[model samples]
Target: MASAEIGVIGLGVMGANLALNIADHGFDVAVYNRTEERTREFAAGAGELSSKIIPTGSLEEFVAAIRPPRPVIIMIKAGDPVDQQIAALKPLLENNDIIIDAGNANFRDTMRRFEELKDTGLTFIGMGVSGGEEGARFGPSIMVGGTEASWNRVSDVINAISAKFNDEPCAAWLGENGAGHFVKTIHNGIEYADMQMIAEIYGIMRDGMDMKAPEMAGVFDAWNSGPLDSFLVEITSKVLATGDDKTGKPLVDVILDAAGQKGTGRWSAIESQQMAVPASAIEAAVGARSLSAMTGLRAEAEELLGRPDLGRFEVGGNAAALLEQALLAGKVAAYAQGFAVMAAASKEFGWNLPMPIIAKIWRAGCIIRSRFLDEISEAFTKTPDVANLVMTPEFSRIVKETDTALRTVVAEAVRKGLPVPALSSAVAYFDQLRRARGTANLIQAQRDFFGAHGFERIDGKGENHGPWNMGN
Candidate 1:
């Protein structure tokens, strides 16, 4: 009967919730999972929402359930699975039927898929869905990358099912082909840095100050009222306050120290490096995760080198306040680097990515959502073409105000032998960025001396290379 307004493939955590969200918004959503049992189970569990959910057992049934010029969301694992799904769906879908890849896909893959489907008349959207399971069940920040026509066709449903900030929908067509996924990659990279920095601060509080989890939770809860009011901070407080069921200790203490990551953070770092934008904080965070996974190696190293016992951690004033400011400062640096990478990517891809709109949508329904993003929206709105985000007046003031705190925090952490790679990288990034003339001249000279690669003469001299003696 083609009664469903949209169709969702895959019944994973994200896909199921997204389908429910669509159905909750008064739209009939046809759903299909590779395993028919899961699809039936989802429908049975939907309860009241089941009326709006069309459970299809096969791809043909799923395709037949949707209306003409269908908008089908492929919410499955990325890479080859996505390609395989597309190949399977091609013969079934008609011209103008939209296929949306709502996965954590690499932008390069998105671009390649777009190229492959250009002549097929099947509109492809590389979408980036943010916020976790809860957000997916309610609403998420949706980033769509596709043709304007395709976006226009689906904007109603997309807008209806997206999170709102002050009555504004947190969904937008960022750019063509891979733009949405690219932004999402950088978003995750920033998330990595944000989380790592927070952990570093918690390490200081725990190991240095010998503070308990509940006490730290109180401080984090307090910070949530201030500039650090974000989803991550709010959750951090909750996680710290939670007690373990078995041992009655803080839940965090009983948990493993290691962390796992998908490829998005690494992609962000790789893309930033390829674009010649220094995202040291993001890189450091990635490296830290890799190191964390080496549990045996870390344990062996600890046994051999011994934990640093350099005495009580000291700051001139309130350590908590200093840590807060330092966190804020590190966040600014990480965000600046992320935005700079996006800026470079935009140029390289000719996406003309809207900086303010990106910040605007991120203000809600995303992991990194915060009061600071609202400020970022304003800054970018005022100075759209600024060389870097840190150069904006609002962020510039923040960096300056928090500079001393960040310096003190990093200095103390280093002295106490606390691992603060991400935070320390933020400091080095800021220092290197602010320097008018860096030591790169010596690097150029060294390169020229070794390979005769040539260097630019500062005073407009004739020869570019140094006349180093070959005999020496």
Candidate 2:
């Protein structure tokens, strides 16, 4: 017997697709939107003979359409509207009914709402759905957080509807309380970093070697033969050859340098800072985006700025190939920064989120899904307690072997006056580790001069002391 008497609210692109997907799986689905016309249209259109997709005009009718203990999935915007929807649905749904918020919501808010609704005996699940509108209709990556009882109640529907990444559905029990939203939050952060990495590759190609889109696309395609193979890279090839919309211009030269960001990108940056994890690559990329969006100022800067000139690449030569390889290296570092942020958050929140499961979840449908995810998935499955993504042996080997070329790439980019934010940040991370400077020891010297702090002696002679005189 199929227990998929699921109802979906907010039939925007996401909700509409999700409803169709569930119906395709033989679930008796009842969908409701704010408008009657749309509700009627989609039902008439997608509710073919193969599937049953009922539509309702209002909340009462939508509620009435489903049976008791309904597993209603909410796909609307987060915050006040969600609260309002719950209030409206409260009058109709029986106690112990499970409400799943499949929208991208803040974890704290989910926790608060769960407690608020607990008294009514209605279960609230804060689920993070990724893979965009397409994934929602087919299968999307889904991260869930709530009480065990609430999660178990809704697990069957979620698993059946969610798209598969690798061999598993894009779903997991993230943790207790606010863990689901938190994990989703980090997932978005990783996505931001990954996208920015591909953009940096384009910039390096365009600036360092003056490669066009098609030319660079070919190189990216070639790179995709190996570890650098990725969804973003594959798409970059299409975006390049597709050209610009109005002018039929090669998109490389036609598109504006300006980039726009949604709230989640900014949120990820903010949260990483709060958690004290070095999300430098993503942060730098965000900064680069903000600067790019200031078009007028950027245009003025372009006029004022002189292009940097580079004579040659002597570090094993082959500047062109080296630039491409370095871009790949930066891609690795950007992912590292993102994983670091996630790891720190996981530790802070006590989520114990499985990295391999997450990597598998992202391998197919999400924006960050890439060939690299397979490697990560393997590493974490073997060693679930990985301290960082970069520490994995294969990843470390790739990085260490190519570091010289990677450094050369960043140097050339700096010389060419290109904005390779993620790339530059990536190289800086590698350099920070390569040279083990005792910055903390130097800090102690400064602290001793100002605050009379004690210092350790290296020579085994000098009293192990600071509070020495501060000379003008």
Candidate 3:
């Protein structure tokens, strides 16, 4: 008898929580892990949900437990490990069995895997599951990419286990092959930009204003009740409020400044560059992380260059309000860049991504979820082909009103000799986009003089060249 509705491989935190979520939603799930001890431990602690969970000792047992046209969800390390799992399952799966890869996989690899499994008559889906362990055990924002036929086979279960926005499932079939992962990569890239902007404002408040952590936490708590309301903002408040248990110091202060990344953010920036989209804010965020990793070099450089005296500066009254506005502006810039990248990718890949749907799905159960996204969804819904989010009436008004505050924050950081790359880049990008004509004509003239790169004339139709006299 076919027992489990689906089988989940790997008993890692995400996999375990997801299996439980499936079972909790009234679907029997068979789970397997490479180590039997871990599998046994999970089974032992499953409690009441244990009745709906089938703990299999081997891959064969796990495969056998599911019905024909079996749906297998793989949650493991991406790249080679994903390929290894697929190879292991190929022989076990019959025609039309579904294999969903739920990891932060590069889209190219997903496309290759999709092709590899096409001949075997098995369906391959590259899905992006956002939100962490808690969201997985409750509901996650699911982005799935596969054939419509394959999606039909498991859509019910997928939808049932995904977060909802206005009673609609947060999951959707973004496109075929790698579209889901591609969008997810962009999601993470935007997350990096957003976090960097917040950190920049925090630096201004802490170093320039000398504000205490609890005071900053109070400001963030207040922002949570306004347009900045989001998971990240809410958590920022908590993180600021929390103190180190050992020394009673602010936890963030005690923690190391170094940050780590898993490559998706870099990939998104690279893709945007390749597509010729100006995601300068995202690039700046990634560059800031890279620079942060050079702690030894930075310390040595600081010693050699001497530190700028910031003691005279005091970010006084209205600093919190100024920071709030700057954050909102930076967020608008970062999201505009992300959406632009996606728009270009959709056209390049023939994905026809639904921007409004993407915004709607991201409203909850994702790292960057915000009330701002609700406004973004409405903008797209009102005009699907809006050139940029900043140009949208709702966002434009906010940006217009907040521009002064953003400029004020950046100027203060500059005078204090603090690095505010993400926020500064956002302002630069906004200025560049808003300008009708730029100084780039001189660049074209320079290129034409040296390399005969050919420059287009504004007054005429054809490419024109200038005759340069070499001083002899």
Candidate 4:
């Protein structure tokens, strides 16, 4: 009957929840899954909201149920499946119909898809949705990338379903083509670094200080009320506090140490390298995940080199306070590197990405939502043209204040043989960043000596060759 205002394809966990969210917002949503049984089940489970949901048996029915110039959200497994779905839907959709890919797609794929849909009267939006299963059902942060007109068409519904901070929606139109996905990738990369740093601190507490799970959970809970307040921190405390019913032990202690990654963090590191920007913290986090996955190799290495017996990890004073400050410093470095990479990408791609808006939208709905992001938003709003986030006055002050604590923590971790890759990388990054004159001059001279690659002289002599005495 074409009565449904919108259509959602692929009723997986995310898709089903998003559809329910849309229906809850007073929009008649038509939904379809590959299996007809799943679609029928979803409709049946809708209960009181069943009337607002139009369950379709086939693609034809799904397309027919939505009104003209429909906005269809395809939330399925990313990559080839998305292309296949889009190909199938193209034949059924009319001109001006919108196709939104709401998945964790690589920005490159998003750009290619946008290009493929050009001049066909169909609009393509690469939307980055964050906040997990519950967030999907209640509210999520939406990052939209497409033409302004296309964003305008779906803004109302998207805004209505997004998390809010101080009565403002967390959803926003970031830019054209792949901007949303690119930003999302960086978001994940920063997430990797944040999680890795937290894990490193937990490792220090467990192995270095011999702390128990419940005690550490109390510390994390206390930190949540302070500067470190965020979703991940809250969850860490909850996870630590939880007890395994079967084993009668803290659930986290019984869990495996290995971690899994899904490529976004690696992409962030690769793209930063491509742009010649240093995102070492993100890189270190990605590397840590890779290393974690190599459980057999790690066991072999640990066997070959016995675990360090160096006793109690000692900081100068107040271990908890020092760890908190160190974590904050590392977070600053990770976020600084992430934002710097995005700034470079924005220029390279001509996205004209609004940094302040990006930060603002991230404050409520996304996985990385925090009071810290609000500070970043305000900082960017004040100094929109800053070369880097750390260069801003507010961030500069934070860096200065936390510098000593970061140094002490990294040094103590290194001394005690605790692995703190992301945290240590932050120390190195800050050291290199603050250094006015670095040792690269020697490398330049060596290059000139071996390959005749000229070096720029400090005494106004541009591109001068170094005199190398080679006794042949």
Full candidate order by lDDT, most accurate first: 1, 4, 3, 2
Q: Cα RMSD to native, each candidate?
A: 0.9, 3.3, 1.3, 1.1
Clashing pairs in 1: none
- The alpha-carbon deviation from the true structure for residue 55 of candidate 2, after best TM-score superposition, in angstroms, is 0.8
Q: How much lDDT does each candidate structure score?
A: 0.94, 0.77, 0.91, 0.93
Clashes of each: 0, 3, 0, 0
1-472 in candidate 2: lDDT tens per residue? 3233888998889998888888877788888887789888888788362257777788877877787677788989888999999888888888888788888887778889888888897888888888888888888888888878778877777788887754678788877767777777777776677677677767766755567788887877777676677777777777777778788778767777788876667777888899887777778777877888899987787689855566432445565567567766777777777777777877887777777777777787677777887888887787677776778887888788778777776776677666677777888787775576646788877877787776777666553556376463
Model 3 CA deviation exceeding 4 Å by range? 312-317, 469-472
TM-score, structure 2 vs. true:
0.89
Residue-wise lDDT of candidate 1 within 353-441, one digit each (tens)? Answer: 99899998998999999999989889989998999989999999999999999999999989998889999999998899999999999
For model 3, how big is the CA root-mean-square deviation? Answer: 1.3
Candidate that would win on TM-score: 1
Best candidate, lDDT: 1
For candidate 3, give the lDDT of residue 449: 87
Residue pairs with backbone atoms closer than 3 Å in model 4 (clashes)? none
Off by over 4 Å in 2: 1-4, 47-51, 306-320, 434-437, 444-472
| Model 1 RMSD vs true structure | 0.9
User: Which wins on lDDT, candidate 1 or candidate 2?
Assistant: 1
Residue 22, candidate 2: C-alpha displacement in angstroms = 1.1
